[model samples]
Target: MTKKPRLAVLLGDPAGVGPEMGVKLLARAENRDAAELLLIAPPSVLAAGEKIAGTKLDVIALRPGDPLRFEAGRITHLVQPEPAGFAKLGECSVPAGQAVLQALTVATELAKHGAVQGILFAPLNKHSLRLAGMDEEDELRFMQQRFEVPGFTCEFNITDQLWTSRVTSHVPLREVADLITQESVGEAVHIIDKALRSAGIARPRIAVSGLNPHAGDGGSIGLEEIEVIAPAVERLKRDGLDASGPWSPDTVFIAARRGDFDAVVSMYHDQGQIAMKLMGFERGVTLHGGLPVPVATSASGSAFDIAGKGIARIDGLQHAFDLCVQIAARA
Candidate 1:
């Protein structure tokens, strides 16, 4: 029999619904059966999550520096001590940010050493991350820096039926056009194609979205489609990739949803995000592609308003875990 892939699962933020969602995800028999899970969080946080979720997990808890073991039918939790003055429920604070940083650091180290095959984290607050002193634009960049990945990397938003990636993310609208070069566009397409294939799609059909309205209408609206995007698509096609478009961003998802393409590469963040979230907000997953190891999280952010309400949905986290497992198993 094949060994199950070991995964490091982090409870996103102490003050958010991450702990509760982690508890709920682990309570399922099927999740436990699928992989050897290492649940990482503070003891206080896990207890609070069990209380909020009303579902206690059978976890073998370990402190820092303790030897790790993965037992059948049980989770192995690494106890991440809560920082002093950690934020209270639904509040963002430096202590909460420090704790999240610590957890991610440990998980990244494990992945670097090949101790874990994948990392699945719940929703985290960017505000808390910033408060904790993360200077990078986002956690994906932080991971890239920590792993020292020198090549192209991008965030992938996915649903059960469709996958989307962006050339430029977390940038202002005014700067997006200048950033959309043929090299950047080609990198986005190449990475998404590789990611989809890693997830078991043999030959992914990718549709590229244009930067301007109606894809520049043959250069009447903008020259980016004619000059940058079209040339990039042609270059990628000549390189033996099944890539097409400069498709109109407005209707790209319509074709993608109708089974026209396996994935869509967008010019900017909101172009793809708005469509994916609209299609399935509760089940969307954000995958950090081009990393040394598979890492995934729910597309949804830390819902501070709904923290500790016992009403946070687990569908997105579940999907994230499922996809992480798929990619990790392949790795």
Candidate 2:
């Protein structure tokens, strides 16, 4: 019999819908049947989530670093004490941030030590993370720093079967043009290619979106396609990769959604994110690619306003869980 992969799950940003979504995910018997789980967070946090979900959780309590034989159909946890001044729903404060950071830290360590095969986190409030002393710009960067990963790493936004990778993420729009060089574009293509292959797409077809409007209109609108984007595509082709593009950003995704390409290497964040969200906001997932251990989460943010309302959707988090399992099982 094949053993199920053990995954570490965290309820992120206690003040947001993360806790509620996590509760909903665990409420399903199928989720527990598919994989063994290690749910990390304070008991109070889960209790609060259960209140919103209207269903109590079945969890085996354990401390961090405690030895146990992980079974295939169960959820375990190392509970962190609820911090002082714990913020309520819709409040982004240091305590909420600290809880998120602490959960992520422990889950990641479990992955690093081979105790868990992958990690999945619900949406987190970036503002709270910063307030908790996370000096890095985002969780991906923070994870890279913590793991001391030496190779390339990026966040992959996925909707349905289509995935998108960007050349520059979390940068100002004004600086985007300057950042789109041949090296940068090629790197984006490479990473997306690797990500697609990891997700079981063999010989993945990739589209590279041009930086300028209408692919620079042959230098009439802009010259980035002529000067930077096109060359990267050609270079990737010469290296025997099934890559094609410098396609006009406007029309590329339409083809990708219609089954033309396995993924798209976008010039910047919003170039691809905007389209993916529009395509399937409820089913989108952001995967942390090129990490030694698989990591993923809902592409949507923490909906603080709807935290305790129990109306927050769980589709995105469910998609994240599916992808995490797919990648981890293969790993």
Candidate 3:
């Protein structure tokens, strides 16, 4: 008999569409049977989500004396810490942020200990996450600190069509210049290369997108192509990887879609994300690699703007879980 895969999931911000999305994912059979999934969440939080999403799932309390209800009825109850603050749905509250963080901390701990194969965090509100005392603006940064790894984050989107990333994310457009470096671009290339190979791509061809128009127009525009990106490509090629570019951003992605390469690495956040999202949109999944465990956060965030609408797109969440299962199998 094969042992079931285990995934520790965080029910992000009860106020957001996370609850609704979670409902849709758990309802699927592939998720229900292939793995043993444990949700690290508060009882009240889960209940609110269950009610709003209208999906029934087995809820096992992490805390003693915590409230729990199954699809048909409330099953066994356990005792748990009472989350403080207002349980306001569809709004940002300190309490909701704290709850989301609490669940994540627990889930990450489980993944770290190898209790679970992977850690899956649903969409999170960046501001709310910060209010939970995170000093960083994104989950990747927070996880990096929590795991004590530096310079190790790349978001991945997988749709019915394509997947990709940027060398820089979450920085201002004006700040893109100061951040692009040969070392940084090179690292992005190398990491993506490893990831593709691990996914079973052989000699994965990596295409790097230029920071400036027409790849610096032969230094007439900017030198990032010549100075920052090229050197990295050279190093990668010398390292025995099939890497190339500082290619023109305008046409490289189209070439990539036409089968020119396995993955197109870009200079900044939107450079890669724009195309990826356009292709993947609600279907793309964001991956967090180089952590203690292969953790994935949702492409969508706390949709406080649309909580309980029964309308949150769940392809991303489902993919997040599916990816978690795949990583767990590797582990």
Best by lDDT: 1
lDDT of 2 by residue, 1-331 (tens): 1678888999989999998999999889899987889899998888998899888887788875677555555678678878677777898899999899888888777788888899999999989999989998688888887777875678899999999999988878999999899998888889888878878998999999988899899899998999888988999999889999889999999999999998998998999999999999999999987788789999999988788999989999999999998888887
Which of candidates 2 and 3 is the stronger one according to TM-score? Answer: 2
Across 1-331, the per-residue lDDT of candidate 3 in tens digits comes to 1566667767777778886777667667667776776667677766766787787766555453333233322222232344787757677777777877776666666566666777777787877777768777577787777666777577665554345667888888998899888788777877777766655677788888899999999999988888878988899888998888989998898888888788888888777777877666687788875676778766766777788777788888887787777767765
- Superposition TM-score, candidate 1 onto the true structure: 0.98
TM-score per candidate, chains pooled: 0.98, 0.96, 0.90
Model 3 stretches with alpha carbons more than 4 Å out: 64-82
Q: Positional deviation of 235 in candidate 3, in angstroms?
A: 0.8
Which pairs of residues have clashing backbones in candidate 2?
A: none
TM-score between model 3 and native: 0.90
Model 1 residue 134 lDDT score: 97
